[model samples]
Target chain A: MNEYLENAKAQMRKGVLEYCILSVLSEGDAYVSDIIRRLKEAQMIVVEGTLYPLLMRQKNAGWLAYRWEESTQGPPRKYYAITDAGRQLLAELDTAWQDLGDSVIKIRQPEKTHSHEKRI
Target chain B: MKNVFNICINGIIFGIEEDAFKPLSDYLEPLKAYFSREKDGSEIVADIEARIAELFTERPGGAATAITIADVNAIISTLGTPAAIAGVDESANTEAQPCAPRRTARRLFRNPAERYISGVCGGIATWFGMSPAILRIALIVATFFIHWLPILYLVLWAVIPLAKTTAQKLEMYGKEVNITNIEQSVKDNSLDTGSPVQTFFRDVDSALGRFCRILLRIVVLVIGLKLIVAGLMLLVAFIVWTCLQDVLFRDVVKWDFLAYEEMLRHIISASSYQIFMICSVVFILLTVAACLFWGAQLIRPFKTGNRMTHILLAALWAGSAMGIVGISLREMRHFTNPNSMSETFTVPVTDTLHLQTVSANMKLSNNAVTGLYFDKSQQRFFGEPTLNICHSRNGQALLEIRRRALGRSKPDAFDKLAGIGYQVAINDTLLQLPDLFSVSPPDRWSFQEVHLFLYLPENTIVAMDEGVMAHMHSNAHSRTGQQEYLWRVTDKGPRKIK
Candidate 1:
């Protein structure tokens, strides 16, 4: 029973990985390690392997561009930056997420209509 | 001691223990399999590899060190299995439909734990739900008829990644890679649940592997040592030859160059031959040393100045080859338009003629004695003309002395050929000839040598000393005896005189 639930949770997390990556990159160009740190801070991504495929797909689709930057330690790192296409897609996703959040809030807390909770 | 394998990941070099490399490879293989059908699969894999390399860098003093199983396992857990990530693609492919939970595909991994000789047959047997013994028997039988089967098996063993983890062991048997299967496989393998025959074969396999490794190491060491010794000898010989080329070829080495002293002088003056010799020797020595070093590296691989040395040696070799070819082309000009000059002398029609060599103690200069010594050494480097006995055209005994040489043109060849000095003294019935012919320096070697033809009339009898046999052509069947013997010319040919 626990296995099924854990599997479901992982599946749910996999769906949102691409959106989260795009969102992280939307703020500014970031090194892969920096992006990984941001994702870990949000507790949205676990293994770094899972995000690689998503980042590669985004880059291949011309939604992202990357450049090599010299690192203080070790070799140079590849920094990925969001392209215009990526920003356009992020805007659409943001609108859809807002609508979905509103609908879910209305359905779950019908009694407290129009009430907003401050969450961290 | 644990052996470490050097690997390049994302263009960065890393050393990892042999035991840990298997599990790490196993962890990466599934990720590759998951993205294989994707449009940007290889790029995704490359990114993943880079990320792994980055993670290794973050490890405590682990940047260039050997990565252990613990490190690999931690990374694998953090990355999550490919099965965990399959949902997104599956859901997208199904067109917004609820994604069905898919069973993880079973992977064929070589079972090293129970392996006898690479464990390929064992892993395959487990995959097919068959006994490993049966597969081993079948393979052995097939190997007898199909000569290449053993080689193919070795190639497969090398290519297939071994199943080191419980998850991998479960996958090897086509079992689900869930927790229960992993737990069961671990328990089953740890506890001796396998048959006695399997255990025996496993032990034998491991023992054989150790033996093979030791044997291979000895073979490589012996071959490496031999190469080093051979290379050192070649280098020493080259040094000695270079230092003593002139002395060795001139005095110590009694080589008769047909006594063309002028030709020898010309050859020595030309610097190209010397350059050709030195360059060739250097090239050969360096190549030998390179081969020895390569053998040593093969025996025990380690980082060295491999590329720079290779380039340097290759360039030197090429330069030497060009020098040899260019110098040889120039040398070839000295050997054209071969010509011969003949001088005929009349002799009295004696009933019996005796041909003999001058005594070793006869009146001769010091140079002549050394020339005789060189001839006696049997190290003649130039061609000597044949002495022929033929019937005279004018029914008289005539001695024809001919000297042959090669030069740039007809006049030059004739002049060089005429320069060859030889003397023949006729005393009564005896004709005496010098054993060693002389040639002076300032002239390049021109294959100069004299040919003596004793033109005897129909009834004239001839006797030749044993020394004359050295100059006689092989086809001239001169009847030779313990002492000088006479031969009478008959209708058939020269017949031994009673």
Candidate 2:
């Protein structure tokens, strides 16, 4: 039963990772390390590898952008932010996520729509 | 060793190490490539990256942290696959400009490069959302390893590219496609030259640099060739000395003990040529030593700058070598002498008269044995020559031996025998043999009344040989210090001092 819930959560997490990353980028320029921290706190995505490839994929797709900002520690690091395309995708992903949660509940328990506080 | 693995993402290469970055980079590349292909998937990848970055910020800065592959796989699963993103984008892209610039989030800059290869160039391009080719080429040209520029170019070419996934693309131009390139490049934008003299010197400096490089290359080539030659010579000398040296020693002291003077005589005679041999040995040693010095010079130390120490060291090295050679000719001559003179000589058979030509040639024909005296009283091969002897392949007709003996022949003896008194006779003769021969007289003979009689092996023509006389005179005059002792009749000649 726990495995089943975890599997669903994992799938949901995948679809929503873009939204989560964009959310952090949406706040301000964040280094890879910092972004990882924020995502972990939100329990959005726990793996670190997914981020680099995902960042590359989005950069390729022209949804997110970056600039090189010199740091005092060493050479410059690439700071990231959400593009307009990124913002649009995040909105769609956010709505979809909410719909996904609501639809799952509506399907599993058709007669219970009274309140939002429901325990798994 | 924390072996750094070069990780290439979006066609850019980065030397990524620390277990954390390695797996992170490995996991990111393929996923990024997949996301870039799906239109809406770019957003998916970007979101996932942002989330990952958020996680990184959450970690306490420490060496023990390691990013595992499971962490990557889990995040990848959450980000959804390319096929799903494509399906969603396809269904959503019905209206005009349906892939609208999402206005939901805003940020100051784009962290476009994720575990990307040397982001120096890629970062510059992504900073302005420009194509990376020009930047990459510029970086390549400026790289200090200009000879290996092609290799580096290919690596960067393969590792870094325009952002591939939605996340990377957003990151690249993600900084609202800023006009960041106007000032942020590593290359200087303005050239300020106010002084003509400065410009002139700069030109001179560059020209001088070219000249020096050309000259240095030629010098290095010549030195390298010389070094090889010297090395080969050293090897040959050492091998010959090591292998044949035994034969030389054996042939001299053991096999044919009598030919010691004929061949080995030059080696161990009382006035043996150990000095010359010592000089030669030193020369060979210096050859090897010099070669090694040059061999060590070939290594390059610094990464970017010229090796100044190489030049100075080479100069001092060569100078010191010459100095060492100068000193060695005079001093280190005692080391490799092959000559072994008997501790003492007998005088009965080596009578005072025949001792001068013991190691000298006599005007005698083959099939004639010269008479040599050995003194049982003195126990030395003093005057004449040793009787029992062995000759080389060309058999000996006359034995030239070096023995110290007193003067037995009076100066008037040759006058009485030749019927010529106080008159020197000079007849030049050329004797055929290998190597040079020397003459020595007994310590007791009086030079003024000395007369030499060649009891040469009978049957040969005897002549007043000028070559022998001149050589003997030179030998006598050049003595270390005069004992003033009368020399025996020189086997060299019947040259009476005029």
Candidate 3:
């Protein structure tokens, strides 16, 4: 039962990871390291390695684009930016997130009333 | 000190320790494989490499510091495993997945870790999924039947590269070049969670390895037994040959009356001969002892002696070998200077002159010794002389006797030549020569030899006896082992008169 809960939690995280990457890129043009830092700060991804393939998949679908930039510390970095398609996808995901939040609140309202009655 | 390699990752050069490099690369291999299924797989890998480079640069020592295994493990945890990076639950995969791609093509590389000599056999055993000990034993047995096997082994040693890197080691065993296997190989174990088929093959490989190891142990035991037997036999032979020379080899060899040391005393000087005898005895004893000890140790490994005992035995063997070499070099000075003395006697010219060989009136004994003969009656040693017939430079018939000996100097050689005695008698038309020359005592056997040259005038006829055939050294005539032959001395050489 615990294993199923852990697996379901992972699935839920994975489903929203792409939407989070596009949202992070919508802010500004960022390199892989910068993007990974933002996603990790928000607890959207566990490993930095997981973000590369998601970003690649997004770029392949014309939702994101990247450019090579020289770095002072090491090799050249690939800077990623949200394309017009990516912005459109992010706007649609924002509305969908809002609708899901509203539905959860409405469903909890009845449960809260029943729990309160049981307490009385 | 750990070996350090300079590697370029994502166009950024970094120095990494050998132990660290294996795990680091192992972590990257599966990531590369997993990402390769995507459209921009290479780009993703390159980006990952770039991030790793950045992480390395951000360390305390920066890029100047060599990466350690701890650093690599830290980086791996941060990046996560290939399954984790792919967002797949590692726990679930472990329960369901096979350990690695089964039986990839194995490459030939010398295994440096588990090696006895240069890792050739160890590498071959690993390649074939067997035990190294078995391969080593088979090679040793093969060396006896195929003499050039050592040369081929040397060639292979030079040709095969050592599996120095983790990926190379994985390739050597035909393990898939992936993160999990690399990690497992580095840790020196198989994955705890593998499918039933992978588990079955692993069990079989280990079982075969165990079987080969047992066979190798048995072969070593048998070899130890053989060596003990051989060493004991050699010891007994040496004792019999040295102590009971007269009883064991009396009829076989003429020197059987003299003991081993006594025979040496006849040839070498008194003072040096003693040293030679001591060195030779020590050498023989040490050799036999070493053989026995080695055999015993192989039969029961590390059961008898410690490192100190081995060191002492090695030192004694080396010392005895050096002593033998020194004594031999000292004895070789006697043969440095060789001198010869020749005498010519004019013979009566006749149409036909008879040439004959006279024996010493002693029974010819069939002896195994060569070059030197012992005269029991006179208590002296005699050596055979050579006889040759040639045309005379002048018109006179002449007979020349040349005696040669080796000594310390010219005069010493001439003094030793006085010990060599060869008698020749000219009776009008008949010439008689002694078959052997005597070397009396105080001069020793110093390669003493005599040569008789019978020079005849042109058209002079000479008749040779059958007894002289043994001493004949003439290439002009075809020796058919005939009883007697007549030859006429011509300008060119002696021509057979039939």
What is the C-alpha lDDT profile of model 2 across B377-466, one tens digit per residue? Answer: 332232222122221222223333322221224432222222211212222232222112212322111111212222332223322233
Per-candidate TM vs. native? 0.50, 0.25, 0.49
Error of 1 at A14 (Å): 3.2
True contacts kept of each: 0.54, 0.03, 0.68
**What is the C-alpha lDDT profile of model 1 across A1-120, one tens digit per residue?**
998897678777776777788899989999988898999999887766667767777788888899988878666778999999989988998898899889998999976773444321
Tell me how each candidate scores on DockQ against the true complex.
0.34, 0.04, 0.40
lDDT, candidate 1, residue B158?
A: 88
Give the lDDT of residue B250 in candidate 2.
Answer: 56
**Candidates, ranked, DockQ:** 3, 1, 2
lDDT tens readout by residue for model 1, B1-498: 799998888777888989999888766665554455467776777777887888887789867678888888887787665544443445454444344434565577787655657889877776666667677768878989999998999898988888765556656656554433333344345312433356666665556667767988898888888777787887777665556555565666444323323233245345765686677777787677776786778668878877887788789888987877777677768777899878898788888888887544423212332232233243222233457777665777888988887877889888777666567898877888766554432134566777888788877887778777666654555544567766776555466667
Q: What lDDT tens digits, residue by residue, belong to model 2 across residues A1-120? A: 998797577666777777788888888877766787899888776545456656766777877998877766334567787899988887888798899888998888765664444533
Regarding lDDT, does 1 or 2 come out ahead?
A: 1
Write the residue-wise lDDT of candidate 3 on A25-98 in tens digits.
88899988788888789887777777777777788899999898887766567888999988998999999999
Q: Considering DockQ, which of the candidate structures 1 and 2 is the better prediction for this target? A: 1
On a 0 to 1 DockQ scale, where is model 1? 0.34
- Distance (Å) between predicted and true CA of B238, model 2? 29
Candidate 3 per-residue lDDT, tens place, B1-498, comes to: 989999998777889999888788768766765555456777888878888888988889999999999988888888877767764424454546545446679998998765656888878877777766667768878999999999999999999998766567777878766556655554543322211234554565467667768988999999999888888988997788667656777776654343435546667888888878787888888888977887888898766668898899789889888988987788888878999999999899899999888887664322344556665544567778898888887788889999999998888888889878888999999999887777856337788889988888888988888667667786555568777888888988888886
- Per-model clash counts, in order, read 13, 117, 0
